[model samples]
Target: MSTDLDYLQTVLPAPSARLAGKVVLVSGGGSSGPGWSIGKACCVTLARHGASVCVLDANLDAARDALCAVKALGAQGIALQADVADAAAMERAVQAVMSAYGRIDILQANAGIGKVGGPEDIALADWERIQKVNVDSLLIASRLILPIMSKQGHGSIITVSSVAGMRYLGYPHLAYNVTKAAIIHFARMIAQQYAEQGIRANTVVPGLIDTPRVRNTVAKMFSADDFEQAKAARDRQVPMGRMGTPWEVANAVAFLASDEAAYITGTELVVDGGLIGKYV
Candidate 1:
């Protein structure tokens, strides 16, 4: 008997070279929690599609690992280290990309941090940190890329968000939720203002993905057996009866960044295995 994986692969279309010869900058393109993180998956998928990628991460090692993986796939990649929240640092990073690639065709602002806290118990410093990482970083990076993209008359900016921004997820991460919601609006506003300039911005809001971060967080939230049980239960809540992989999310991002999605802008593509549709 054929396995489910085999059946799925048979039904799903093969990957395409949609972004051939393009230059893409992927921020936070590193491993965060466990398994393949979304940023890492994006870097790999983009490279597989024939793009020369710049892997930017706060963790130098993680950035290097992502670049190495891309290179292993016979694609070109460079690892960059930068704190996305630092305006000057981000500007320099963009300048470096311009120097190396002549021009950037895609910008994936996927860096973010998740912290748990309620409105009454949330610490000021934690709140500030989450906001700075999640929202401020996107602002600074986009600000630096806007002029370059405007001059080129064509570019794509894809931001990673979460369904938590739209509805509750039985968690107390107020700051994370707020920043993610802001990102959706941010992308929409940028799309509206820059469509005339040929720059498109969109948000990829992933649902409960089976990334390392989610797994580790789940482990922390429940006992070992309970964690597994709860995870299975949560997965069953989705219409597909499973959590999505980072590669699935990356595939959506690649499409939005590629010319294939040229006419699509300021839209939120939720890749949640029907979780948002059922719950929200």
Candidate 2:
């Protein structure tokens, strides 16, 4: 009941049929805390555009919460809980989606985690954990879904990366940076390998997006006491002088998932507010 009903009610994009007759499976399709995470926004945005959505998250409550947004938009969708890094669990989630929708026209890998540290100091376990969740999960999901897409003779695979992947953001999260970089290449490879089969793959790179995850995790790294200060610091880092909203990223994902991007593949759509191109 304490959810961001205001944003959900008034701030969402106007509905359209840009993605009519498609099914989009979003991994980690839930909010990390309050408000809209990129994954949750993607679910809502895609649904608003007429794609039947499958909200898959490790947290059932979070998944259902996102599903509510999809359903509220008068869109069809199902929510399921699973660790995206777990092959068996993801397989089951795909099975459940298949049972309900019969086919998947798009796969969006949005599951990711980070531990702030450089190689000289980062724990080995932490390194492996980030890779497993961020990289391996994408691999597993794409591996399982590729054949289904191939059979359909068309599909879109979208990935979420960060400006961190392309360059340092004044942070030292080595594992996170590596995994994100790997994701871009992973999508590119899949794009080339599966182009003939009609499966298009691309990555979305966002910079300084203001979301719950940033307020909770990244903010703490900057200011242990005042999150507002942390937020301000991050905002100034963007050339646009402000952090982006989750809906902005969602719009990019929805575009990639739609036929409007039919001729696009093996590319990274940056939603970074000009942060990556800026020079200090």
Candidate 1 structure lDDT: 0.87
TM-score of each: 0.92, 0.96
Query: What is candidate 2's lDDT per residue for 165-211, written digit by digit as tens?
Result: 99987868899999999999999999999999999999999888888
Residue 35 CA displacement from its true place in model 2, Å = 1.0
Q: For candidate 1, write residues 28-93 as lDDT tens digits.
A: 999875447899888888887889999999998888888877776678878889999989888888
Give me the displacement of residue 154 in model 2, in angstroms.
Answer: 0.4
TM-score of 2: 0.96
Best of the candidates, lDDT: 2
Q: Which ten residues in a row have the lowest lDDT in candidate 1?
A: 1-10
Which residue pairs collide, candidate 2?
none
